[model samples]
Target: MDATPGVISTLFTNAKVFTGETETTFASAFRVTAGVVDWVGDESAATGDITVDLGGRTVLPGLIDSHTHPALIAGTAPAAECFPPAVTSADDLVAVLRAHADGLTDPDAWVLGRGFDDTKFPGRRMPTAADLDRVSTTRPVLVWRCDAHSAVCNTRALEIAGITAHTPDPDGSRFERDADGEPNGVLTEIAAVGAVAAFIPAPTRDAQIDALVGLGEELASRGIVAVCDLLSTRIDDPVATFRTAVDRGLRTRVALYPGWDPVAPLADLAAGDREGQIRIAGVKVVLDGAYSNRTAWVHEAYPESCDHGLRLVDDADVLAAAEWARRNHVQLAIHAMGDRALDRVVELFADAEPWLDGIPSVRIEHATIVSDDYLARLRAARMSFGIATHTVFFFAEYDGYEKALRAEQVPDAYPIARLYAGLDPLALSSDRPATAWSGADDVMLSVEAAVRRRTYNGIDFGPEAAITVPQALLLYTGRARLLSPLEGVGQLAPGFDGSFAVLDRDVFTVPEDEISAVRVAETWIRGERFS
Candidate 1:
């Protein structure tokens, strides 16, 4: 048997291909050479090379996570760190914290932890100063909720930050207080959280790079080939740390979008760079908070006080930023979680319509609360991005519709199928470290949530709003590749980058509930196996 014509080493034959666009049964054999697919068909001329028959397992393009904050995972906490509501007793919480702290070399270093649930405690008590104080009196401790919008600090930590009853609330944030106006050590939203964050020591650039590399390795193991990193970068050099990691041989393809600043540090890079794997994609602006935290800027009133949530960044600021980004031909992936915030983002896009000649298509990140009308508008405008995988994880804790969301807001805001139906560019992601959200977990868990619209408790949240299994996979792969808008990134085709994952089981064939059980057995990047 002569070498299969142009085949490199092997041909992944006999596997069903979910080509990222449509499911196909005719793709019986495909050849991978030099890291990219050289050919796909029923007949190949070569026969001497190795061929691993897949029997009938499904094969997909590599999964892509469009949003992630991996630094939070690899630093400060163990992978098995306990998330709240599951571990109820205060004593158990202390034990968990102590166990985590035991691994750290820095004794006086702040023992920061995250992913606690407020609903799990007795009386649904939010961890108070006393609760955190009991964990470690000698060291200052701060444990943030899974939402990343709230945190409980110990007395020592509070003292270090000088937060007390007398301390005025910081702008754009709120400190949850007790009856006497005393700070209860719980900081809410960005405002109150920003106050204490100002006092915490900033991680060095080397540390940031380490965290990124560590995160990249972890995701590679989980079969993620590309990611849109939602990291907050410095104004002067947005991609400096990321570029350092790439130069140091980090394997994952990263498309970076830094927080919006007037200076536009990455504008020059975007202008000059045409490379796909490592590029500056856009400007990320936060218009409001997240749904789980109840800080999203909604047009309708929230049940808590019949009040609309606060807008973190004003529309004027968003428009100015959008205009600048458009003028520079950079895309804008604005973070708009609230309905009102989504409205504001849409308006900003509208404001830039005349100048969009040179601009990249705009995308809206976490439009979690967007209405159907607005979604149609986005579709009409040809703006992309319906990224909402991480939000589905928040519903894992709730039991029913009314309990999870108030009566009037029964639909719960995240309209997955609507985006799909409207033919928008929806993507899947895990806003890690900020949320207990994970990319590996999203492939299975979030897909089921999107397909079934069922919460972990088995209650149907919105079955009609659910997306299909095929559509979910596309979001994770094809739509996600658009992050770098990297040419030939996600699909397994000639002229495309050779990046893919071998699965332990076929994801599409599995029972919807058991989808999360499938694991990645192998991952390859640029034609070389990374894991």
Candidate 2:
């Protein structure tokens, strides 16, 4: 993980840095050379091989996620089927898959699990393939349900993918069937879980470069140097698997993006002219489906159903992929959770707003349902937002898709206090394997659900959509520095990138329900520490 050559080693002295448009505290002492920030507010003209004091604690800027899926929680297996959080019967999720297949001794190899919140079980149903053949009718499983859209598999993984009950349902996805029309192994979206996740296998490219180098050392032990990879791997080349995990260093800075491909990994990132260290930068577009599975694409209807949602792309291919991502300058996130896929993604970015050439901004990912005339067309097209605060801690465990999205649009759910009294600037993302990927306790449970919009049933589901823990740490840091604000990214100034995040306590002086118990006492990143 080299690349720092011309000077400075590491300094860090008694810190506090969070200066992303200040709230206070610039009282610093940085100096991380060869990895940027060659001196941020003195400390005896900073020199270094490693100094580190930080006793005064608090140094942020190194969290930027802006939508993830880093190879599904960069798994080393055991993500207990993603987020079942609590099983509460289907024999308590077949005894959590028979104690995760009794620590697997190869009961037929493929036993991958995933998060499973069928709206907190008990009849929010979904698990059949005879509920994973009651946990291994001879292995072959497939779990995934907390909303990585959908998947359940099991009659020995639907007879090893031949998916019976006379298959057919794939177009734009959905294959559950039932009432005697059979095929009920449950699988949806990505055209019915991309035909059984294209028959499993895929992983290797050196196990996707050891799961993107153990997901960049688990986001540099949770201080996350930079991110925005936005999950995608059916493999047929993700820019040669991110240039073989950025020529093997995989140190994490990756602004990657690729998925929703009508063939666009842009020819080996213009045959490697996108320079490397994993930065391809742009092209996401989910277009709808996922408000915890009612299948978000709404323009009403949802309450008791009669389905008026689910539009996974197609408004003439969202105006021809927003005019081919504005004639190829690229960058176009666009997931849009609903509110009619965020008003047809603001009418296809206002019909590609006169071919947006210079590419300043353009993102949407989970811009969870907004509507004050689409927050005034995203503040008159100044557009950019990633939002996903782990669905406010997944509606604080209440469920049934938070009672059918509070009975259909409880005034636009993910509205973090109208994006903090709207002056527009957003980024926060944690859509990991669809929520709850560890480290930094999910960014301190997204700063205690954006400063207590209180859920875990204690109610107040939108106390004016609360916000403030320094505006949820500037939506995971300076509006995630507009996804690569000239690469120094999210902040902590000087030549940037010294990478921080220590936090054991003092999340802006805690007490927002004890900011999810703090604890991440070390993380660093470019300057190294790791965790």
Candidate 1: give the clashing pairs.
Answer: 4-46, 35-527, 172-191, 173-191, 173-192, 174-192, 482-485
Off by over 4 Å in 1: 1-9, 24-26, 43-56, 71-80, 84-92, 203-206, 234-238, 247-249, 261-276, 354-360, 382-391, 397-404, 436-442, 482-484
lDDT of 2 by residue, 345-452 (tens): 676564334433333346777666675667766666644433434444444444655755654355567777776567344666677666523232367776786678
* Residue 116 C-alpha lDDT in model 2: 69
- Model 1 lDDT per residue over 1-531, tens place: 234465565566667766675534236566666566666656354342557666666667777877765534433433334464445555656677777767778777776777766665566567777887777787877877766667878888888888888898765567888899988889887667756756655566677677667777878877777777564453125366666877777788777666775444344444445354566666677777766656677777766567676677666667776765666666677777777787776665643453333223676776665557776676666454335444355445452123335554555456677666664456766666555433424466677777777765577766767877787877787656554465566676656666777778887778878876778777778767788
Clashes of each: 7, 6
lDDT of 2 at 39: 60
Residue 340's lDDT within candidate 1 is 77
